[model samples]
Target chain A: MEQFIDVWIFGLGIATLTYAPPLIFAALGGLFSERSGIVNIALEGMMTAGAFFAIYVSVQTGSWVIGLVGAMLAGMALAALHAVATVTFQADQIVSGTAIILIAAGLVNFLNLTLFGAEGSPAELSTPPKPGGVSLLVPLALALVALTAFVVFKTPFGLRLRSVGEHPRAADTVGINVYRMRYIAVIISGALAGLGGAFISFNVSSYTENMVAGNGFIALAALIVGKWKPVPVLFACLLFGFSQGLASRLPFGSPELLNSIPYIITLVALAGFVGKSVAPAAVGKPYVKH
Target chain B: MTRRINAEAILVPFLAVIAAMAVGMVLTYLVTGWDPFAAYGSLIRGAVGSPSAIGATMLRSAPIILTGLSVMVAFRAGLFNIGGNGQAIMGLILAGVVGIKLGSLPGASHWIVALVGAAIAGGLWGALAGFLKVARGAHEVVVTIMLNYIAIRFGEYLLGLGGPLQEKGSSIPASKSFETSAQLPVFWRPDPFTEVHVGVLVALLAAGFAWFLIGRTALGYQIRAVGLQPDAAEYGGMSVTKITVIAMFIAGAFAGLGGAVATLGELERLQKSELAVIQIGFAGIAVSLLGRNTAFGCLFAGLLMGALDSGAVGIQNDNTLPSGVATKLIGVIQGVIVLFVGIDLVFRRLSNRIVGVFGERGGSGMVKS
Candidate 1:
C-alpha cells in the first residue's frame, strides 16, 4: 500500500507537471491573441511550425537555446502573415487562421520530405535533454504562466490589450493603435505556442508530421474554459493535462474514453456552467477604424 | 431579398483560383522540378480530359459538396459550423448502425432508414451547440470544436475495441458490411473501375434545396436577418434563438447526409482506423468560404476542389513527382486559395484592373474594410 501510494504520487506528479505546462504555454498563447481581438485557430499551425524549427535549427546550430529562439521566430513569422491578412487586408480572422494551419501543415510536411527525405528528422543536440523526461523548458513554461498573468493584468500593456479587445474602435479613438496592439499580442501568442511545440520536439527524438496533433486545439479549449485569464487558464490546462495524463496512464478504461473527458468538460462548461460564457467583445471580428 | 450578382463576383473567384494555381505551380517548380507545365497539364487532363475521370471527380465531390452546403448554410445564419466533421462522423456512425443492425427490411427502405437516422443524429448534435449559444452565451467556435473531439472519440469507441457497434467476431475496430440495398446506386458506368453513384444526384438536390431554403423561404429570411444583424433581428419579432437552432439543425443534417452517402456510396465497409484522414468536414469550411455562403457557389467550388483532389491522386499514381511532395503541393494550393479568398482585396484589385483594361463601363463591388 505504501508502494502503491508512492507509485500513484510519482504517476500523478509526472502527469500534472511535466505533461501539462506545454499545454498551458500554448493556452497562454491563445489567451493573448483572443483577448486582443483576434481568433487564432492557427495556434495548432504555430505550434507545428515551432516544433519543426525547434528541431531543424537545433540540429543545425547544435544548441537548444538557438533552437528555441529559432522556433519562436518561425512562429512569429507565421503569425505576422496572419496579422497581415486579418489586420492589414481585413480578412476573416477564422478563415485566415485556418489558412495558416493548412499552409503550415503542408509546408512542414513538404519540407521534411524534401530536406530530410524522411518523415522525421533526427534530434541533433549533443546534450539531448532527458532528465526523467523533464526539461528546463517545462519549468520555464510554468513560470511564464505567472509571468504572463502579471504582465497581462498588472502592466499597462495588458490594459491596452484588454481595452483593444473589448473595443478596438474606442481604443483607436484613444490613440491606442489597436492594430499594433493586436499584432504584438498575436505575435507573442504565436511565439509562446511555438515554444510549446519546441518542447514537444525536444522531448522526443525527432519531429513527426502532425506531431503537435490536437494539443494546440486542446490548449485553445483550455483558454476558453479558463475564461481567457492566465492563472485560471493554467489550472484549466492542469485539469486537461491531468485528465489526458489519467487517460493515457491508467490501463483500466478505454483510452478513447479517457481522451474524451477534457472535451466533455469543455462541452458542459460551454453549455452554461453557471452563467454565460463570454469572450472578449471584439474577439473573432476584424478591427476596422470607423 | 435579392443579392446583387456583380461581374466582380465571378471575376474575383476566378482570379483567386488562377493565382492559387500559379502559386502551386511555382512551389512544384521549386521543390520537385518535375516540369510544372506537364504536371499541371496532366492535372487538368486528369480532372476533365476523360469522361471516367470526371465521374471519379464527381464521386469524390459528392460528399464534399454536401459538407460545403452544410458550412454555407450555417454561415448564412451567422454561425460558424466548425463541427461539420463531428456532425458528419455522428451521421456516419448512426447510419452505419442502421445499415448493419436493422435486419429484414426491404433493400431500398433499409438504406433510406440509415440515411435518415444519420441525418437526425447529426442534426441533434449540431443543434446542441446552438442551444448552448442561446442559453449559455457559449461561443459556437469553441463548442463545435470541443464537440468534434467528443464525437471523434465516441465514434472511435463505437467502432473501436469492445465497442457494441463493432462487427461480430471482428478483432479490429470496424462495423459490419452495410446492407446491399443501402448503397447509393450508380448512374453512369462508363468505367467499371470508376464510381459515379446517385450520391451525385443527392449532392445536386441538397445544393438546390439549400439554395431554395436560403433564397426563397421565410425561415431563410429570418436566418439572414439574424445573421446580418442579430440585434435588429431580435427587435423585429424574429426569434434569433429559434433561427439559430433551426439553421444549425439543417446544417448538421446536410453534413450528416453527406457522411451517410460517403460511407454508403463510396466504400463497401467502414475503414477501421480512418480518423486520421477524416479531414472532409474541416475541408468543407474552405469550400463554403470560397463559395461565399451561396449554394450555387459551393457547387462550383466543390467541383473545383474535387478536381484538385482527383488531379493530386492522378499526379501521385503517374509518379510524375514524389507522392508526398505532390500531395503537399495540392494542400499548399488549397491553402493559398483560401487565404486569398479570405482577403478579398487580392481579388478585388485584380478584378478592378481587368475591368479598367477591358470593360467599357466602370465596375465597383469592392468591400471597403
Candidate 2:
C-alpha cells in the first residue's frame, strides 16, 4: 500500500504537475486568440520560439525571469507577423500559421546552432524555482486559469473580444476596434504561450531541438475539449498530463503505443465523442470592414 | 480570358520566389555576417555544378513532388490534407512489410505489389480523415495533425525493439533489409556514389496522372465544383461527401507512393528514427503553394525546392557557415515563400506594377480568382 501510494499517487501527481502547466499556458493562449476570431494554429510555432528564447535568454542574462520576458517577446514578434498576415493582409489564417511554424522551427534551430554551436547551451544555468517538488509555474498556471476565467467572463474587454469573434461587423457598428482587439488578443496569447515554453525549457534546464513537440497542438485540442472554457480546459490538460505520466510509468506495454494515448483521446474528442465543439462564428474567417 | 489568368498564376509564384530569395539573402547576411553572394554562389554550384549534384537534386525532388501532388489534389477539393505525413507513414509501413515478407514474388512484380500496397494503405488512412470530417463534423486540420502523431507512434511501435516489425534477432529498432527485387530499379549512375533510380519517372508519371484526373475527367469537374461551392455542387446533384472522400483517397495514394519511392529508392529497410524526421509532408505544402497547386507546377516547384535543399548541402561543404546552419536557413526561406504566396494579392499587385513598367496596363483589367 505504501509502495502504491509512493509510485502511483505521489509520482504521478508530480509528473502531472510538471506536464500540465505548459499545456495550460498554451491552451489559455489559444482561448484568447480564438476568442478574438483568429484561429491561432501558429500557437505551436509561437511556443517553439518561446521554448528556444527562454533558455537562450536565461543563459545569456543569468536570470530566469528575464529569460521568460525574452521568450514572450519572441513569441509576440512571431504573433505580430501572424497578425499582420492574417488580420491586415487578409491572408488565409491556416496558411499564415503554417508559414509561422516553418519560420519558428527553422529560425529557432538556426539561432540555436549559430549561438550554441554543436555543444548546445551551457551545462549550468539558472532555472525556475520548485516548491514542494513542483515547479512554481504549476500554481501560477492554475492562478492564470482563474484570472482568465474572470477576465473572459466578467470583464468588458472580454465581452468586446467575444463580440468581435462572434460577429465582427456587429461589434464594428457598436464601436469596438475589432482589429486592435484581435491584435492584442493574439499578442497576449503569444505571451502566455511563451511562458508555457519557458516552463518546459526551465524544467529540463536546457532547450533542445523539437522540445516543444506538439504540446501546442495538444493545447489546441484541450481548448476544444474544454469547450473553450477555462476550468474545463484545465481538466482536459490535466487529463492529457495524467495520460503522459501513466505512459511513462507503465512497466509492460509498448511505450510508443502507450505514448499515443493523449493524441488518440484528442482525436476522439475532436470527432465529437464528448459532444460538439463549435467555434466562434467569425473564427477562421478574415474580417473585411466595408 | 483563361490564358490571361494562367499568366497571372505563373507570374505570381515567380515574383514570390524572387522576393523570398531576396529575403533569404538578407537573412543570411543579418544572421551570419557573411557575404550572401558567395554563399549563394556556393549554393548554386552545389545544386548544379556537377552531374552528381544534379542527380542529388533529382533524388531529393522525387518524393516531395508526389507529396506536392498529394496536397494539390486535396486542395482542389477544398481540403487541407495536412495528414500527408501520417498517410505516408502508413504507406511506408505496409510497403516495408511487403518488401520484407513477400520476397518470393518474381522480379519487378515484387516491387510493384509493394508500391500498390503502400498506395492502398495510405489512401485508407487519408479517407479516414475525410470520413471523420463529413460524418462527425470534425475539422480535417486537427484530425490530420492528430493522425500524424498517431502514425508516428504506430510506426515507432512497429519498428521498436521487441516489436513485431523489428529485425528478427538483430536487436535493432528496424525492419529487415528488403529483397533486392523489391528495390526501385536504377536507371542512371551520375557518379559512383549517386545512383539515379526510376522513382523520378514515377513522380513524373504521378504528376501526369494528376493533370489528367483534375483537367480531363467529369469527376474532376465535380471535385472542383464542390471545392468552389459545396452547397451549389450539392444543389447540382453532386455528392460532396463522396467526392471529398475520393479526393482524400487520391491525395493519400500520392503521398503513400511518395513514401514508398523514397524508402525503396534510398534505404534498404525502415528505421524507427526516420519516421519522426520526415519533412516531405511539410515540404509538400511549400511545393504545392509555389507550384500554384497545379500538377505540372508542383513538378517544377518540387525540383526548385530540391535544388535549394541540395544547395544547402553545398553550403555545408564550402564551410561558408557552420555545418547544419544552411538547411535551417533554407527552411526559413521556404517559410517566407509560403508567406509571400499566401498573401499573393500583395504579390499580384506588385507583379502588375512590374508589368506596367513594360507598357502593359497595370491592374485595370485583372480579375481576382
Candidate 3:
C-alpha cells in the first residue's frame, strides 16, 4: 500500500506537470488578448503554427531555443493576419478566427509535407531535462503566470489593457490608441500561445500532426472558467491538466469516454450551475475607433 | 434601388472570389514555384471539365449547401452556431441508426425516414444550447463549441471498440453498409460513372424553402427582428427566447440533413473516426459568410466551394504540381475567401463603388446591412 501510494503520487505528479504548461501558457495568451478587447478563438490555430515551427526549426537548427523562437514568430505571424481582419479591417472576429483555424491546419500540414517529405519524428523528451524529473518549461510556465498576474494587476500597461477591454470608447477617449493597444496585446497573446505549443513539442521531443489537438480550445475554456483572471486561470488549467493526466488510468467504462472529462468539466463550469462567466465587456467585438 | 442591391450582392461575392483566387494564385507561385495559370486551369478542369467531374462537384455541393443554409438560418436569428460540424455528426449518427434499424419500412420511405431522424437528432442537440442560453445565459458560441466535443466523444463512445453502434464482425468502428432502400436515388447519369443523386435536388429545394421561410414567413421576420433588436422584439410580443430556440432548431435540422444526405447519397456506411472532427461543418461557415447568409447565395457558394474541393482532388491527378501543394492551395483559397468575406463591409463598399463607377447616381455606397 505504501508502494502504491508512492507510485500514484509520482505518476500523478509527473502527469500533472506534463499537461499543465501548455494549458497555462495558452490561457495566459488568451487572458492578454481578451483583457485588451479581442476575442482570440485563433489560439488553436496559433498553437498549430507554433508546434509546426518548433519541431521544424528545432530539427533544422539542432537547438531547442532557436526552435522555440521560430514557433513564437510563426504564431505571431498568424495572429497578425487575424489582427488585420478583426482590428484593422474591423471584420467579424469569429469568422476571422475560424478562417485562421482552417488556414493554419492546411498551411502547416502542407509545409510539413513539403519540408520533411513527411511528418518525420524529431528527438524525444520522454525523460525530464533536469535530473529531478522536472521539465524546465514547467517552472518557466509558473513564473510566467505569476508575471502575468503582476502585469495584469499592478502595471500601467495592465490598467490600460483592462480599460480598453472593459470600455474601448472610454479607453479611446483617454488617448489609449485602442487599436494599437489591442494589436500589441493580440500579438503578445500569439507569442505566448506559440510558447505553449513549443512546450508540447519540446515535451514530446517531436511534433505530431495536430499535436496541439484541442488543448488550445481547452485553454480557452479555462480562461473563461477562471473569470479571465491570471492566478485563477492557472489553477483552472492545473485542474484540467490533472484530469487529463489521470484520464487513461481512471477505471471508467471506456478509456475513450474518460478522455472527455476535461471537456465535460469545462461544460459544467460554463453551464452556470456554478458561478457564471462574465467576459470582458468588449470581447468578440471589433473596436471601430473614431 | 432593389435592382442595385441585387446587382451589388452578386458583384461583391464575385469580387471577393476573384481577389481571393488571385491571392491564392500568387501564394501558390511563391510556395510551390508552380505556374499559377496552369494550376488554376487544372483546378477548373478538375472541378467541371467533364461530365463526371461536374457531377462529382454537384454531389459535393449537396452537403455544403445544406450546412451553409444551416449557418444562414442561425445567423438570421443572431446566433453564431459554430457547431455545424457537431450538429452534422449527430445527424449522421441518427440517420445511420434509423437506416440500419428500420428494416420494416418500404424502400421508398426508408431514405426519407432516415433523413427526418437525422434532422430531429440535430435539432434536439442544437435546441439544448439555445435552451441553455435562455435559461442560464451561457453564451451560445462557447456552449456550441463545447457541445461539439461532447457530441464527438459521445459518437466515439457509441462507435468505438465494444460500442453499441459498431457493426458485428467488423474490426473497424463503423456501421454496416446501409440498405439499398435507404440510399438516395441517382437520376440521369450523363456518364457511366457519374451519379446525380436526389440529395442535390433536396439541397436545391431546401434552399428554395429557406429563401421563402426567411424572406416571406412571419417566423423569419420575427427571427430577424429578434436578431437585430432583441429587446424591441420582446417588447413587440415576440418571445425572444422562443425565437432563439426555434432558429437554432431549424439551423441544426438543416445541418442534420447535410449529414443525412452525405450518408444516404455519398457513403455506403458511416465511419466513426471520419465523423469525428469532420471538416464539412466548418466549411459551412465559409459558405454562409460568402453567401451573405442568403438562401440563393448559399446555393452558388456551395457550388463554388464544392468545385474548389473537387478541383483539389482533380488537380492532383494532373501531376504538373505536387499533390500536396495543389490540395493546400484549395484550402488556402478557401481560407482567403472566408477572410475576405469576413470583412463583408469592405467588399460591399468595394463592389458598390465599382458599380457606382458605371452608374449615373454616383452611389455613396454607405448603406449597412
DockQ of every candidate structure: 0.63, 0.75, 0.60
What ordering of candidates by TM-score runs from best to worst? 2, 3, 1
Q: Which lDDT tens digits does candidate 1 get at residues B1-369?
A: 344547777788888889999988888888777788888877877787788889878987888899999999899889998888889888888888887777648746877788889889989988998888887777788888888888888887777777777787988788888778777777898687996888899899989999999989999889899899999999999999999999999999988988888888887666557654566776788788788779999998998888987887777666644467766777778788889888988788878788878653555543434
Model 2 scores a TM of 0.97
lDDT by residue (tens digit), candidate 1, A147-217: 98998899999999999999988888889999999999989988998988888777775788878868888
Off by over 4 Å in 3: A119-134, B1-6, B188-193, B320-325, B361-369
- For candidate 3, write residues B151-186 as lDDT tens digits: 777888888877888888789988888888888889
Candidate achieving the largest DockQ? 2
CAPRI quality of model 2: medium
DockQ class, candidate 3: medium
Candidate lDDT scores, in order, read 0.83, 0.90, 0.84
Runs of candidate 2 with Cα error greater than 4 angstroms are B1-5, B320-323, B362-369
The residue pairs that clash in candidate 1, if any, are none
Model 3 chain B worst lDDT window (10 residues): B360-369
User: How well does candidate 1 score on lDDT at residue A219?
Assistant: 92
TM-score of 1: 0.94
Docking quality (DockQ) of candidate 2: 0.75
lDDT (Cα, tens digit) per residue for candidate 2, span A51-117 = 9999999989999989989999998999989899899888888888888888888899999999898
lDDT by residue (tens digit), candidate 2, B197-300 = 98899899999999999988999998889889999999999999999999999999999999999998999999998998777888888899999899999999
